[model samples]
Target chain A: MELLGYLGEGFATSLMPINILIVMIGVTAGLFIGAMPGLGSVNGVAIVLPITFIVPPSSAIILLCAIYYGAMYGGAISSILLGIPGASTAVATTFDGRPMAQQGKAGLALIAAAAASFVGGTISVVLFTLFAVPLADVALAFGPAEEFALVLLAFTTFVGLGGDDVLKTIIMICLGLVLSAVGLDLISGDPRLIFFDQPGFYSGISFLVLAIGIYGVGEILYTIETQKSAPQVTPAKITFRELWYGLKEINKLWKTMSFGSFLGFFVGMLPAAGATPAALMSYGIAKLLSKKPETFGKGAIEGVAAPETANNAASTGSLLPMLTLGIPGSPTTALLLGGMVMWGLVPGPMLFIEQPDFVWGLISSLYTANLFAVLVNLALIPLFVWALRMPFTVLCSLVFVLCLVGGFAPSQKLHDVWLIVGFGVVGYVLRKADYPMAPLVLALVLGPLMERSFRQTLIAEQGNMMAFVERPISGTFMAIAALFFVLPMLKHVKRLLRRDLSPAE
Target chain B: MITGARGKLRACLGGKVETIMLTADRVLAAGIMVLSVYFMWHASALPIGWNGMTGGPGGGAFPFWLSGIMFLCAGGIVLRSFKDSAPFAKDDTPFFDPDTLRSVVVVTLALTATVAALPFAGAYIAIPMFLLWYLKIYGKHGWVLTGALTICTPVFLFFFFEVTLKILLPKGWTEPWFFPLYARFF
Candidate 1:
């Protein structure tokens, strides 16, 4: 009965004309950003965050959340239309999506993606409303030592999870940690990386600058290098029959959808493990388990269904952790968390007790936003498809303008513009070198929090390294980290030894 | 043996060119590393005092640790670059692909110029101009698209920052001139 009451209140709050308009705008902008190669939800949210600072916290958060979900859905369009995956999570969608496009089934593929996204997103939001409070209660028990260990675990897991060159990933992570240090030290009042004694450096590297440079400008530079005369696209029109066809395809992949939604929810609960990895993992698992695994890369409907479902589900799932606990599951959610804090709405165990109205309002609004996104996408697909038909030169140039304005809008500073350009060059070089950029970004987002925890632990223990070992929660986390390190090596060594003993015989 | 000697000679010439590229990249990376260290040192040298806070650490503490870590990583990069035997690898693709290199350099230079001019020109003017050049010259876009972009971009700026959010953007030289016009509408 209480939940129902909250839900009704939430609906009332979300239905406000201004909130509805903001959601609409956010979804529209998010779609554009996400459709562009290299610009993901993080970049999209970061670009818009500065504007939000001036608005009411509730409106700002609603807009940001709308954008987050919008980007997750928009990523599918590019994967289906262009061979390039717009976001990392969309990489799996491309396996089938691109093939579908090649086969002139682009319209159907998009319809399937959008429908699955809506279903998955709606279901995950329901789960979030139920699970968020309990999770927050669990998080409230964590002390500094335990928090520090958890951060360490997150950092290490992210670094090792790259599955590429570990050295490069570690280097990127360390670089991010360094970049995070550029602003004034939070524990001490000292400036840590000020070059010209400017107050700008005191605030440190702006997330806007980092995001625009690495994702937006970096993408432009990359596209410039690989500039090609794109094949002319004839916009594929979807009829009522085709829509029904897409619906049938969704029904056929029900098992994949369910599995993906569950996986996404689980992954989304973890801090920083959001849509991208969940989508990728689900797609990979689906491919591995499929009866016709060989058909996966050749327009297998499951390929599109699984990732599309998982990424959307993960978006909602991530909100669970952020809303319940103060901790965000991804950078976008982190920014949203920042917004909530700025609004004077304290998250964590107290939120449900103190701010039930705000909590319920946000939750109910998500349902409204999801419905709005579906209607918007359905009506606008043709127009967006027309946008895809626009020449690359024009499209790329427009993106460049958005990047600059978006980058500058946050701080109204010139230094951020320079940062964007510099990071663009750095990102380009990293891309050329096959070094992954995601870990670097993840590190940048997590670095400051991790450092705060570390310093707090040291200060509390008077620089005693044994503080972590003494705390049971921290000890368990450390033990888990130790296991993470050992298990991989052990597996590798076992494989090598087995090969040495049994191979060739 | 004579053929092998000829191959070695060719290899030496190729390796020399590779060495030069590698040396340049290494020097650039090293310079950046040194700059980073200097920044870290400078940041650590500030007179900000730490007030003891229970949950939130003081401002300087986090930066100190992060900068220190960055400094270490930068040092590692420099060291690794020096230790590596091969610095560059020649492209297997065609060497004289002007479009590839030209587009990259042009876009990069354009972005750099935009950044340099932002403080003086302001975002409203500089961004539109950049878009115009990028679209009209490099992109070979139609006038309709270019004009639409140029006009709409500032309007977007107006709505997003000035009107909706109430955050102020840089007015630069045009602020006084356009102030009346913008203030009237905004």
Candidate 2:
């Protein structure tokens, strides 16, 4: 009853004319940005954060949440039409979606993708509505000790679980944390990293500047190296007859769709697992469950549907930890977390109770956006495919200009624009060298919180190390964090021991 | 023996690429190790807060400890780099080709130039100049198209960002020059 009552209030708030108009604008713009190569939802959302400072907080929520979900839907369009994925999550979609397009089944692929995304997004929101408040209720009881342990768990999970190489990821996370320490110390207000006595250094590096520099300009530089010209793409359109047939196909494919959505949602809850793994895992599962497993790579409609569904579900499902535990499950959520923080809405269990209207209104708006995404994608797939055919050079140049504007808009600071340029070059270099970027962004946002909780706990226990494990909730979280770090090391040690112990060795 | 290792690295990198990439693995590993030391050094100067006392866990405690951990990790990377099994140990390919590197340097300069111009020239003037250079010089599009895009985009940005969002972008030292134009929007 409480859930429904809050949701009803949320719906009323979200359905207001102003909210609806902005939400539409957000999603439509998100779709356009998402469809463009080198500017995914992360860059698009980061670019819009400055503008959110101008809007009412609730309206800002409606706009941003719309962008997040709408970009997930739009990511599939470029993946299906061009071989290039619009977002990292769409990489799985391209494994089958492109082949289907190449076979002249582009219309069918488009409809199936849109339909699966709708179902997956709708399911995740329903599940989120049911479970989010309860999770938040539990999280609200956490003291600083538990919160520190939780942040530790998130960091270790990324280092140990997210990447192929552990050392590289850890180094990246540490570097981000170090950069975060550059600002005026929270408790003492002493500027630490400002070796140069500049006003800008006093406040520290802006995440918006780093984000625009890295994701926006960094991506442009990356693309320009490998590709000199844009690939031509033919627009794919669906007919009424095909739309009717898609309705029946959806019924037949319900099992695969449900399986993908469920698996993806669970993966999304794991810290930093994100949509790529969710989609890949579901695609594998779908192939395993299939009667004709060999048909997977070659142009299976089920292949197209499964990954698309899972990715959309995972994108929404990733929000669970972000909204409830105050930890972002993926990089996109991390940027969203930063945006919320900028609006003076600290994300935590307290968020649900303190701003029920903002929380529930955001949840309600997801439902609205998911439905709108399906309708828009179905109607405008051809337009996006055409947009894909536009000059890549022009798009890169435009993004370059936008990054400049976005970096400067926040405080109208020339130094901030310089930061964008500096970080853009840094991002491109690190990316080329194969350092993971997601953990870095996640760590940057969570850095101050981690430090604060850590100090608070240290103070509470009067500097006793055992107090961390003394509390039940914090103890459990700390134990899990230990396990994530230890398990990998244990595996490596055992392998070395086996090699040494073997007679062949 | 060193030549053989270098040969293997070159094989991984492709023969035509830069020689710096051959030693890139060790360079990057050492680079991070040095960075970690720098952080630890600065953090050591701040109060390593002992309790709720000493100004609440001291300003330096978190960074000092974390940077120490980072130092250990950087050492691990260095150790790993020497092993043949490391990820980029044999990778010798140029990080970016010559043309690409040239573009990167040029674009970076263009951005720096834009920032330099922002205070004196304003967003309206600086942005168009950057676009023209990017499109014509860096991107190599013709005058008719580049001219249209360069002229039109700043005007579009002005309305969407300033007029709609109520966020004033910098008018610059020439703020009074736009007094007549400013009366229309506010």
Candidate 3:
């Protein structure tokens, strides 16, 4: 009941004319960015974050969240029309989406994707509302030890479950953490990692610089290489008749959508796996459990619905930990987290208590954003189709210009701009070598927190190394962290055993 | 172990040459190792050990230990690349095909040059020039499209950033040209 009361007040705030307008603008912009072949939510958020300085902090956050939702919905558009994923989260959507487009069912697939996304967004927002308070309550009991353990658990999940090479992932994590430590030491206030003894080292490295570099400039460079030729957009026309039929068809997949929503929410809460893997898993499971499994990847509607629901759900779900626990579940949310910190808002449990209006307003805006995303997405399909025809060069050059300017906007430093370019080139090379960029960005966002908590615990416990394990809650978290850290080794050993057994067989 | 595995792979492929990707894997790993050493050295500026009185590790300990781990892991990557069963060990594809390499290198150089010029030539001048180069030279876009964007982007950026947000972007020598606009707007 109290939660409902808070939610009502949140709606009061979110329904303000300014907030609604912001949401509309954000969703529309996000749709275009997400509809573009090479950009995704992370890139959109990173590039646009500095520009949000014009708005109030709460409205800015709402705008970014709206963009996140719109991007999730928009990602499917490209997947269906361009036969290429607009974002990595839409990769699974492309399995059936492209085939459907080819079969001249692009209109129906788009409707199904939009509807499924709405369902996912609605259900996940409900779940988020229910879970956020409870999670924050639990988190409120945590001390420095628990915080360290949780952060450790977050990192170990990447090592264990991340699809990238474990060594490369570890290297990236270390690199990001070290870079985060480049400024003054948290406790001693001593200058550190000041490469070339430059003065720019004093302010430390901003996560925005790294994110814009990697996702913005680096992505363009990577895309320029890969997208050598333009792709043909499959023309789609949605009559009202097709829209109604598509909605009816999606209504039949309620069970699959619900299942996807639940699975996506849970999986997305894990820092190592966000919307991309959640969508993939949902698609895989939907296929396995389908009445006509073979129909999947052959223009089946369920194939499109399942992943669409999951990815949208996952984006919302990822926001839970970031708001409640201060650990971002995805790179996009990591950027949001960074942006929030810059705006002088502290995340984690205290935020909910201190800024109920902001938290609940953001939550309620998700519901509105979802509605607007689907409506605007359907209404503007023709616009997207036309926009998709624009040359990639124009988009790339604009993004490049934005990156250079956006990089300098926050810090007003040519040094930061230079750093963005350097990071862009290095990040692209590292990515080519299979280094996972998500963990690197996440680490930079969480590094200060991790270090602060870790040293705090040690100092509080008077150097008692066992203090982390002795506390019951922190102990449990540490146990989980240990298991995650060893999970890859376990997989390796299992593989070797299987190979040996195969020889005998 | 390295030579033996390579010999087997070579024999299997009948002497198919390893591509630059393989060399890149080793080089990247080696580069990371060197970077880790450098990080460790820099991190030692602060106390890189535990402080008994404070009951916590020194400020440098975290970065120092993390760098040490990075070094070890990078070494492991190099070592693993030599193993017959390692993923990249069996791959024969080039890290970057010639076409990709050329485009990537050109764009990177252009981006770097633009950033270098930003403080000196100012955002308005440097950004438009970069956009022009990207669209006209590298992308080979038509003059109409390139010219429009190159002109319009600076105007939008100026009004949005300078007038609306009051975040003054660098104008360098072009600072005087913006003085009249600033007088009008600000």
Encode model 2's per-residue lDDT on A217-278: one tens digit a residue: 78777877766556657468899998988777777889999988888887887766888899
Error of 2 at A11 (Å): 1.1
For every candidate, how close is chain A to the native chain A in TM-score? 0.89, 0.97, 0.99
Could you give candidate 1's per-residue lDDT for residues B1-186 as a string of tens digits? 445445545766787443444444455456556755665566456432343444334455454555556556555554554433323434234322457877888888887887777777876777788888988887777899889988997887777777776666676786787678667866
Model 3 per-residue lDDT tens digits across residues B69-135: 9999999988776666666766777788676788889888888888888777998899899999989
Q: Rate the local accuracy (lDDT) of all candidates.
A: 0.73, 0.81, 0.92
TM-scores, chain B, all models: 0.60, 0.77, 0.89
Interface C-alpha RMSD per candidate, 1 decimal = 4.3, 2.2, 1.0
Docking class of 3: high
Best by DockQ: 3
Candidate 3 lDDT, tens digit per residue, A1-505? 9999999999999999999999999999999999999899999999999899999999999999989888999999999999989999999999999999999999999999999999998999999999999999999999999999999899999998897898999999989899999999999788999999999989999999999999998898889888878999999989999999999999999999999999988898999999999999999999999999999999999999999999999999999999999999999999999999999888999999999999999999998999999999999999999999998888988998888889889999889988998899899888888889999999999999999999999898888889999999999999999998899999999999989889664
lDDT of 2 by residue, B44-92 (tens): 7778656345435788777877787778887887666544566665566
Question: DockQ for all models, in order?
Answer: 0.38, 0.51, 0.81
- Model 1 residue A46 CA deviation in Å: 2.7
Candidates sorted by TM-score, best first: 3, 2, 1
- Listed in order, each prediction's TM-score against the native is 0.85, 0.94, 0.98
Candidate 1 DockQ vs. native: 0.38
Residue B21, model 3: lDDT of 75
Query: CA lDDT of A6 in candidate 2?
Result: 91
Interface RMSD for model 3 amounts to 1.0
TM-score of 1: 0.85
